[model samples]
Target: MSAPDLLSFAKAVSSGAIRVVDLTQTLSPEFPIIALPPEFGQCAPFRLEEISRYDERGPAWYWNNFTVGEHTGTHFDAPIHWVSGKDLPNNAVDTIAPEKFIAPVCVIDCSADSTADPDFLLTVERIESWEKQHGRIEAGSWVFLRTDWSKRDYKAYANLKEDGAHTPGPAAEAVKWLVEERDVLGFGTETIGTDAGQAHLFNPPFPAHFFMHGKGRYGLQCLTNLDQLPAKGAVVVAAPLKIKQGSGSPLRVLALIASK
Candidate 1:
């Protein structure tokens, strides 16, 4: 865009001609996180430590340290998060180009299906059907699955069973189609993972991680307010923390939508 175009956009934002929607879930200890099996490592929940509350430590400034997992809360998934893209260049969060932090988004609403079935899996047919209604999912765009899972209460949000958590996500075929055919920049979901909760049961388990990362794409998880976005035309800005060699990190996702 030219200098005038950029200036006009800034003015529009200042004048409410455009709306900025926050798509990130609140990061707190209460937020439910993904649980792992007894044999595997686990992600830590968000924690905060109060260093000083204007008492003694520092009268002038108040700062506290906190601990949390890389994938805690609403976070970004770098290509390096999966084995498929481990060897790819710029696969880590810190190394990825800043230009990629922003991109057009295609929100595919699967709320009804997900509400009917906790284990609902997005299929290629569903994606194609959505395309029939909306325009084609252009390359380098973020395709977000809107399941409204973020609205669930704490217990139901995790929805863990004796076997594992029951959640909605993309099927292996859908992941393949998005990566191979559409060439999306990344995939986002209201669920904890880009893949289904029982995705391990699928052939080539966790296909979203397998195919998307393998192609050096990205991922956003634990997102919210997708219902506020239109099917297309919104631009998503998801910039991850610059953790060196980090596989993933919590991020603040914002969607820029033009006013009608």
Candidate 2:
């Protein structure tokens, strides 16, 4: 029951040859949220207004109305998000190709570095070493950075202080290489962003977002469950909420790992 295409992948889910991994953080008010500076329009945190918890608002059902930023929690970022991809046609979430949402993935482990320094940046050399062990990262594949960063608590996850949040992510050059060379489908991380927290210091600033999206590539932030995947061969299924003309959207990021 091997999947030759997307439809086969869907069918594999039913037979259990391919398993679904919930690569998302539970969205709730308690989830440690990303903090953006004032002045710029801020991305809202995941907050739910209990429409009914089965006690008051509605007795028959238990549900809530939530307002969250497009990039909140486990989310997807479309090209039109930044000013770079602004003029590109079909740049927004709704306009992205549905097929782009599914692709194979390669996990680059950097747990030791992330543990030592919260602001570690993944370099191109690191990615190369990963390839040496796991075989080449195929074109149109996802390069997920496994930092084991999701194990941290709120205060540590954000690690914000007088300066800003500290987290591990792609170096500017690393992202450029991934796009131009490997031609990865996108990048994913357990941290709050695809770019390192101090990415503003990089020339062009936030190069991961700049080039990745400017080229119509995608991004996944606040991811989890990378440990469950092999170094390669797993396919990612990250479907954003079909918001009209939206820049990005919180999504359920699932990984399909084929069992031998």
**lDDT digits (tens) for residues 69-184 of candidate 2:** 88888889899997888889888899888988888999998989999988888998988888888899999998899999888887888888788878899898999999999888
TM-score of each candidate?
0.98, 0.93
**Candidate 1: tens digits of C-alpha lDDT, residues 80-119:** 9999999999999999999999999999999999999999
What is candidate 1's local distance difference test score? 0.94
Checking candidate 1 for backbone clashes, the offending pairs are none
lDDT winner among the candidates?
1
In model 1, how large is the Cα lDDT of residue 141?
Answer: 97
TM value for model 1: 0.98
